[model samples]
Target: MDPMHRMEQLVTELNQHNYQYYTMDQPQISDKEYDLLYDELVTLEQESGMVLPDSPTQRVGGELLKGFTPHRHLSSLWSLDKAQNIEQLRNWNTRVLKLVNDYNTKNPDNPLPEPGYVIELKFDGLTLNLTYTNGELVQASTRGNGTVGEGILAQVRTIKSVPLKIPYTGGTIEVQGEGIMNLSVLNRYNETAAEPLKNARNAAAGALRNLNPKTTAERRLNAYFYNVGYSDDIQFANHQEMMDFLRENRFKVNPSITYFREFDDVMEQLAAIQESRGQLDYLIDGAVIKITDLRTREALGYTDKFPRWAVAYKFEAEETTTVLNSVVWNVGRTGKVTPLARVEPVELAGVTVQNCTLNNVGDIERKNLKFALGTRVFIRRSNDVIPEILGKVTEESDGEEIVFPEQCPACGFPLEQRGAHLFCNNKLACKPQTVARISHFASRDAMDIETFSEKTAIQLYDELNVREPADLYTLQFDDLVKLERFGEKKANNLIAALEQSKDRDLASFLYSLGIPNTGKSTTRMLADHYRDLHAIMNATAEELVELPDVGGIVAESIVTFFADPFTQAAIEKMLNLGVKAQAPEAPAAVVEDSFFSGKTVVLTGTLHQLTREEATQRLEALGAKVSGSVSKKTDLVIAGEKAGSKLTKAHDLGIPTIEDEDELVRLLNQQG
Candidate 1:
């Protein structure tokens, strides 16, 4: 048999198998049989070096891309207005009725038919705009600002459910759909992942936008086409007709789309969808209600940002009332005490919620949660994250009051009030504080001492009298081997790790010190500005405040931290023990004319093109002060794939954001 012909045959057979399994939820061949055919295709393509573009082998991810290119959408993908409740939905229906009646009154001779509605699940995933030219999938992009999007064709090709070739050889067409990670697939992937993805929506979006197509393939994403956004040779009287056309062309159309002639029937269907939402394998935040009649939709037309003929019926955010059983205070590495509330175990967002954060004693008073014990409190899981106590169900609570601790819970030391929080001054004597500090010092972001955990710290503290970070360098190998569970090999490895940590950079060493209210970004800034460790230690609060993004509080914290006699003594001992906190090389001259100059910037999420350190370095060199969190003071935010709370906060604060990775790269590469 001819190699090319054989390859073609295998490709067709494999594609059919994929469609049957992924789209139809049925398998025509066993896994072993499919693998045999796939292997043959791979071998033929490799030997002949004449791989077809639509080959099933092409679905295997290709090389890493430099950055995304801008793709102008054929037709705009408009945002949908949301209806929170049935009343809002009814109001929308009334508006639709008025529009249809007005259009008929204007054209009395050719009266429009009665409006019907089509309800489809609004999937909680990344929106995809797929462009097909002559029945071959030519381009795929994200719905960026509706009119234009970032091209992600290579990553989109990895989704096996999406057909590479369709039966219709029309001039051009754009299909709109969602790229989702199935809940089952996500669970399976997370079981083996080093850092498990927390949310399915974020996982799918991050994978599709990833620079490496191989990562997209590994995620095993799925897509369901719903709308034919653009086409040159296609016209339909209704959404059902358009859907039928999509199915005929072998696009994976979702089966959940339903049509109804009455508005009341649409309302009932929304209730049913919300009820059965938990049973679905994928996530849906809402159900979309659109007029089924094409003429009615055309006559109603669009608003500035949304279609007047369609609205999304959003499900309420997950919230419930649960009894607050008790509140407990816990000490952290910084010796600050925080309140943790224990509530009756209740289900929220498909997870058991029993623990919630009270933030501090100040928050308890503000929310009236100080007297919330033994009473029901309203808890909400915002954005599918950790549940928080909004407030007590009733304003007047007869329950017991949560007493503020006068002594440190971990060490029985008398606690001192510092503004809204209480702190233990006996830093070295406090057991929990000492253990946590040691664990943090050896953390990956700090000194990066491998295999050193909090459990190890407790064991050392109990047996070896190790109380501080400087005490680590004084440990002997013989002493470690004698401890329980410390074999000769393990002891040797720990010693080697500790020895290697001595050469960590100044930024890391500063972070390992666990300075109050200071994070990695602040440490890096200080290290870059001062250059010398001694210079930073001797710097004044006024001088520190002159740097960008450094407020009076942070300046005072730094000055006071260095002024401590204990801290100075610890530093001296560590230095005497040959712990060389090496400074970074001299930085480039600050660029005053760049866009980032004089701006306070925040970097969030995982950036594929540049490491967080690299981004911070570049920003600082361009005269930008990189911050750890989003605030009103933030001038710009550079968000990458899977950005979460910080990104949301930035938007909520109305701060400008740069979400396009390609644009970020361009800005980063610009010269002064």
Candidate 2:
């Protein structure tokens, strides 16, 4: 069969199966068969250089959104207070009991007794609230800030189990639940997903919160209600009654709901839940214990951030024991060297963790870590954060002794200790440092050179002597094809991509320089301040620090980077190869400054025609302050597709909003 034909067949077949499983709750193909097809399609897409947007392999939240409407929550969704261990939980119980005692003492005529607790599994997923009116599903929203949320009603309609219309028409009803991915679904999805969702929480969050409803529909997300947030017509005596009411309505409620009269009983149930957690279809980071009586919950009231009525008992991080094979230092693009543990692969939280972070030399010494060649070690995964070594499993050491390297591994140079970080200081001499710099320079977030994978980066350096980003621009087609696995078609595509990257904007070019601590957003801020590459290169530390987000350390690094002779030569070389960054035009005198001027504005989701950089420039040009977050100080917020937590936050704060990029431009023109 022709490759493109097979790719189309696979995409069609996969989409059908995904729809059946996720949307329809009926899968025709087995998990094994789906994986085979999905993997083949991805390989073909990569080889053919024709990755379809709708392909199953391409669904990790895209450029945030190009707009979002606010959904006001019917009932306030209060965050739970957390207790990390049993001792902390006991302390919380004491405090709660004392609060009740004090209340009873004050009102002896109508004294209240100890409240019974309802124990439920705390699902590691995005919280969703669904509302039904007259037996018909009316609205759905995320737990944005508890009071108001971004309405994801369209995406909510995709969940198979969530009834569009409930059987019992008990007036206006609001159900609260978690949008979680089944462990089985997560495993299958990871096998072929372009970028794996990491865990159930992220999978659910990414699916429901994404700008694309079709993507959410394809996640097969499971929703299990825990409580009724609000009900205008139906009222329950206790939390258990609410659960019963939901189940009676054919609404999916967590079956694990249990009532406990004593604190000890709650603790016992929490232990049991922890022991049997592996049997469940989703991940639970903690167990929620809430007061069973609704009246008691109201009486207990809420703190500033959390409810006094309930507490979440956090589970310990998932960990596994493995032998530490060796410890090696890895050189980053900034030339900072950090110790990396090479451990024997051990499965922790369903993923095999072979390498874990040792943090820094101070962390290593403080923890009394000795990464002896054959020592048993403990590795842990908390939430979805990087796997970390949590001290040694045993004190005994049998193999090679752990020793800090005096010289750089890639280039023989004396390692310089600066604060906590060890630097190579080799500059042009370090092969790994140079290669990593080139790789970072060509990365998608930087120059967006899609063809420049780490493997390809190494091949360019070793095979073709392409040491720097500039060297890539000078590569000949004949020279590339001679290298193993570099087909004429692949080489031509890579060369074309490289040629196109030369015309990238100033921010991208600045970010591609691999300046330490100066990320994409920071680079844009610098670009806006300086306006051009030449101006940025000549900037002093004092001038660099004056820009937004540019701290002292970042300023020093930028200044030092440009001061280096090799860095100067590299930029000059790239410029000669037609790497263009058009200098910003002088600002026209403002005829009349609008309300947007001198205001802090936030943008969320993806923008159309305008990248975040482009939006930042246009907004800054109007004398508006573009902030990454939404706060009380924020004057306005522009929402785009799949606007997540930030957009909800903006609504909750009652800030002025712009619907889209066109509206924002109009505002700058003082027309809106």
Candidate 3:
């Protein structure tokens, strides 16, 4: 077979599997099988230089969205003409056949017979127009007026299912697709949301519009390319060919699409989509039917509102009813409060849901929900964790009205409202807050006290009057042995772990401080600036602002934490109790003299040559900052045996990979 044709076949196969894997979480091929095909496609693409849009190589996400910009689409993305029933669909088919018949009568050479129609699921999602410049995804936009849209390149970059770059086709092209929020994603998001989205479409739109690309990426949205909105170098003979073209380029086109010469076949396909809609990850409100022949569609051009060649067949709403029992409130680790609806256990989309989130007090009030416990509420579930109460059937109920509490359930701290969010004011004194802080302090990312657990912290709190991080260093073996289940060995282990934590890295020490707004990464940045703990403690908010990613709020948080009398006293007591704060290790050399200098290197898998701590220290000593994962900023990856996705991701970003610790040592020494 010709290389181009082979490439096309390979593209279709790989993209189908990608859709099954990324979007559907069901891979048709094994990892080895997929890798073999992928390697073959890469080789073929290098040889031919004509990569299809649907190639699986495109899904390596890299670009970071800064903000949405104004973009003028190459072609107008028209709204489809609508049809309600089989009778209306038949009428449209009749009109299309009549147009084809007339065109055949007028032109002698290209006389047309009855045209076939292409049918695909009309995904109920945000319309996104993706523009490619020589196969690289340059911009993604929302359909504003068909001609112009807001470019959502940043937000789109975070969507894992979409390809960042495809094999080069000759010129610019615009692939129109739908950005769909999975029903499951929306349901999960709503559990902690201040204002829950009504449905999948709204949720998708919200994610796309989000200014922070990181948040958008967290939403795990999927996209399906359905049409070629514009193309400068490529032209399709028909809609089916266009679908074929999209697949060849590695774009995720709808798998259920079909071409039917007869009107009855089209109806069957539509019915099949409707029947299996419940099983789909994405939401679809209708079926789209279009004249397969591109020339015929052109002749039957546009109406004022929608395309005359295509029609949308909308489905009836999938709604049902349930009972609202009681509402429960949950406090998160961050102390933010949210409300949940404890409903009568009912099955929805095959899962029995007993509770659904009411979001917040504001959400409940805005919706005018008076459906107290035992009220016959109109509940509807759409692939959600909990069914939503559509509205109340009755105006009144015998149950008491749900009200927001003034005090925290776990601790007697007064609840304070900051905009829509509610927080426990007594941060250090609160039980949940203390447990959360201590647990975070001893976490693997902080002091790395693996033997210490939250349950153990609570036990210590109950018996030993352990109040803060400083109190942890003051624990005696006699005190531990007095607690339930704590033997001599357990007590010794706890003490040993605490001793080990005393000499933790400067970054870890900073992170474990339990300072508000300071996380693992932020602590690392702070350590990079101030090598000594004393220097950092003395720094003002103005000085903190000079560091990378440190905003006014974060600066203030740092200054305020160190300035606090209680915090200062706690640190003094901890230092006296053998909790020594280690200073930052000296770098091997300055950036100009060292190969490893100012580089972000990731260490993965098991190393026989050097321990993880030894390797990290060696690299840091050479001015290289070691990170846990791969990103665009990663300079190199030192992989040992069984190195996982971090190594793969480094390769995808075109970063260098080194095996064993010898090469790393050689590079550092040679450069130095």
Best by TM-score: 1
- List the global CA lDDT of all models: 0.87, 0.77, 0.77
* Clash tally for model 1: 0
Candidate 1 lDDT tens digits, 1-672: 988888888888888898877766557788899999999888898899999888888887999999999999999999999998899999999998888888889999988888888999999899999999999999999999999999999999999889899888968999999999987698688656755565678789999999999999999999998999999978999998999988887777877788898888998989877765655667788899998888888888999999998999988646678999999999998889998889999988667999987777766776667777999988756554466676777778679999999999998999998777889888979999999999999999899898899999999999999999899999999999999999999999999999999999999999999887788878877887788889999999989999876899999999999999999999989989988887878987999999899999999988999888888889888989888877666899999987766775575346789999889889988977
| Segments of candidate 3 deviating more than 4 angstroms | 1-196, 202-324, 330-401, 590-672
- lDDT string for model 2 (431-496, tens) is 788888888888987888867788898888888888788898999899998889999998899989
Model 3 quality (TM-score): 0.52
Number of backbone-clashing residue pairs for each candidate, in the order shown: 0, 8, 10
| Residue 322's lDDT in candidate 1 | 93
- The worst-scoring run of ten residues by lDDT in candidate 3 lies at 56-65
Provide the TM-score for each candidate, comma-separated.
0.55, 0.52, 0.52
CA error at residue 385 for candidate 2, angstroms: 3.7
lDDT of 3 at 53: 56
Q: Tens-digit lDDT track for model 3 on 405-485?
A: 888876867899887667886766777767777787789878888589999888877788887878898888888987898
When sorted by TM-score, best at the front, the candidate numbers are 1, 2, 3
